[model samples]
Target: MDLTYVVAMGSERSLVVRPPKLNSLVELLTSHGYSVVGPILRDGVVVLDFIEKFDEALIGVESAPRPGEYRLEEHKGAVFGGPVGPMSMKRWINPPNRIAWSARPEGDQVHVDTPKPRGPRAYLGIRPCDVAARTIFGEVWPGHPDDLVIVAECTSVGETCFCSSMGTGPAAGEGADIVLTEFGEGSVLVRSRSDRGAVLLARMNGAAATEDEIESARSRVAAAAESMVRSIDSEAAREALASMPDSAVWDSVAQRCLACANCTMVCPTCFCTSINDTADLDGVVQRTIRWDSCFTPGFSEIHGGVHRDSVAARYRHWASHKLSTWWDQFGTAGCVGCGRCITWCPVGIDITEEANRIIKEVAHA
Candidate 1:
C-alpha cells in the first residue's frame, strides 16, 4: 500500500491480464487508499459511479448513441463495449454543487470554514475522449495530483463519435496513468504511461504481452478510428466561425434549438458556473457554487440587459466559443468529440453538423 514507489521499472513493456484477474486491479487500488469509480448500469444506461468490486462495472454493456437518442444494449462477452456514457470525468472532478465556504456568527466574531479535502480517487474504464476532455478541463480548473486515471481504449465506435477527427482517441492519449485495451477474448493489454502507473501495474503481476497480441489489440483500436462516421475539421471550423458571424445557419439551428441548456450540461468541456449565498435565521451564511450554462439568459445579463437575447445568438455564442474562440483563451479547442451533446440534446442539434455547415457556407462566400 506504499504508493510512494516512484521508480518506473519496465515502463516500455506491455502486460496482458486475463478477464477474471481484472478484479485484482480494483482490490489493489482500494488497498492503496484510492476510491475507485467506473461505469455502472443505472436506469437502463451506463454511468460513472463508485464501485467496490469489478462485477459492479458495466462489462458487457454497449451504448447506442445517435442524435437525440441514446440506449444501452447488451454486448455479450465484450469488455468496455461502449465508446462513452452520458456522464464524463467532469462530474467527479467538478461536482454539480459544492460549498465554497460557510460563515457563522460566534459571539461577536465570525467563524469561516472551507470544505474538507477529498481523498485520492481512481477513475477506471474511462474512455480516451473523456481523458482528453479531463486534460482540457484541468487548464481552467486544476485537478488533484493524487487522482489516478485509467483509460480504456475504444474497440467499438459510437454513432455520434468524432474523436478521430479531433485527434483525441480510439487509442488512449497522454493523460492516462494506465491504458487498457480489451481484445474481446477474455484478455486485456495494459500499458503504463507514468511512474505511479508502472508501480501499480507491477503489483498486478500480469504476464508480458507477445508482440502479435499487442499488434492485434492496436489494430482493433485502429479499426475503431476508421469506422467513425461523424467528423469535423477543427481548423476549418475555427476559421468558419470567426469569418461568418452573420451566417444564416445560426437562425436555422435556432429554430430547432429550445435553448434548454441540454447541450452545455452534457458537454464535457463547458465550465461555466454561478455562485449563490444563502443565510439562515441562526446567523449562518453559506456560499455555494453550482454549474451554469451559457444558454441561460442570466448568464449573459449585465447591469442593463442580457447580451444574448435570442436563441440564435445564444447558440451562436456557444458553438463559436467551443470550436473557435476557445483556442484564443486556452490555446486548444474546448471540445474533445465525446458526442454527448448530440446524443443528449432534446432536438438532436449536432455541433459537428452545425460547424460543418458554417464551414461550407464560408467556403463559397
Candidate 2:
C-alpha cells in the first residue's frame, strides 16, 4: 500500500491510501499513538463506538440504506457506515464524566486539583452529514474548550445523505486526519487531509497512497455522492421558510408530533446542551453538560416565565431553526437532511414532507 498526498488549495493537507486490511490501518494509527474508535453493530443499531483494536471492529464499514429503517447488509458493496446513532458529539469530544477540579480547604488557603486530558483519539467511521454537523459546531465552540481536544478520527458517508446540497459533505475529506472509504473490492481507500493526517499516512509504509491513487479516491466520492437518495433545495428552502414564519405549516405537524427530542438528538448539526450541578450535602457542586433539544419544554424558558408556551411554537422554532434562522445565526441550515429524524421520530414526522407543505402554502399565500 502506497500513500498519495493531496493538499488542495485553501484546504488541509490530506492523503489517500489503499489498505490491504482493517488491521493494517489500525496498526498504522496505534503505532503512532493514536487511539481509534469506529462503528460497532451493538444493541441492534450500527453505531459509532470504541474499537479496542483494529480486529475488534469493522462496523463502520457497513452502511445503512433507503432510510435508517433498515441497514444495508455489510458486504463488499456497502461501507461508510453512517453517522453516530443520535448520540451527541459530546460522547467523543467531552469525556463521559471528568472531575473538573478538586480542592482542599485549609485554614485560610484553598488548594485546587488539576487534571489533564487522556490523549488523542480517532473515530474510524463517520458520515458526511455528521461531519457537516461538526463543521457547524466547530464554529460555535469559540476559543475551543480543552475538553474538545481529541485528535481527529473519521467517518464514511452514506448514499442517503444530502450534505453536499447544504454545502457540507458526502466527502468529509477535509477535516479529518485519516478517512476510510470502502471500495467495491475488499480494499478500503484511506486518505489523509492534514499535517496531522500526513504523519498518520506516512506510517502506513506500503499503503500510503500515491498521487495517482488520490484521483481514484476522488472518483469514489464523486460516484457515491451521486448515489445518495435524499436531497433538499437549500436556496429555495431558505427563501420559502424565511417569510412564512407564522404559517400553519408547523402547527399542522404538531398535532401528530410526539414532542420527543428525536429530531434534535438524531441531528448531527444540533449542539444544544444543558448543564446541571450536582451538589453534595456539604454544598459542593459537580457540574456536567448534557445534550438538550428545542422540543424539550424547558429550552425556551425566559423572563416572562416562558416565551414558547405552546407545543406548536416550540415545534415552529425547531423547524424554522433548521430551515431558516440557523443560517442567520450560524451561516448554514441546521440540517444536512440525513432523514434520521424522520426514521427515528417514533411517529414518523417527515421533515421533508412538512417542508414541502409549507413551501406549497407559501406559494398560495
Could you say which candidate leads in lDDT? 1
TM per prediction: 0.95, 0.80
Question: What TM-score would candidate 1 get against the native?
Answer: 0.95
Provide the lowest-lDDT 10-residue window in model 1. 1-10
Off by over 4 Å in 2: 1-19, 55-61, 65-72, 79-84, 88-90, 95-115, 142-160, 207-219
- In model 2, where is the ten-residue run with the lowest total lDDT? 145-154
Q: Estimate candidate 2's alpha-carbon lDDT, on a 0 to 1 scale.
A: 0.59
Residues 76-176, model 2: lDDT tens digits = 43433443354545456644344566555556776655667566666565665555566676775422232111221223444445656666566663455
The true-versus-predicted C-alpha distance at residue 88 of model 1, in Å, is 0.8
* Candidate 1 residue pairs in backbone clash: none
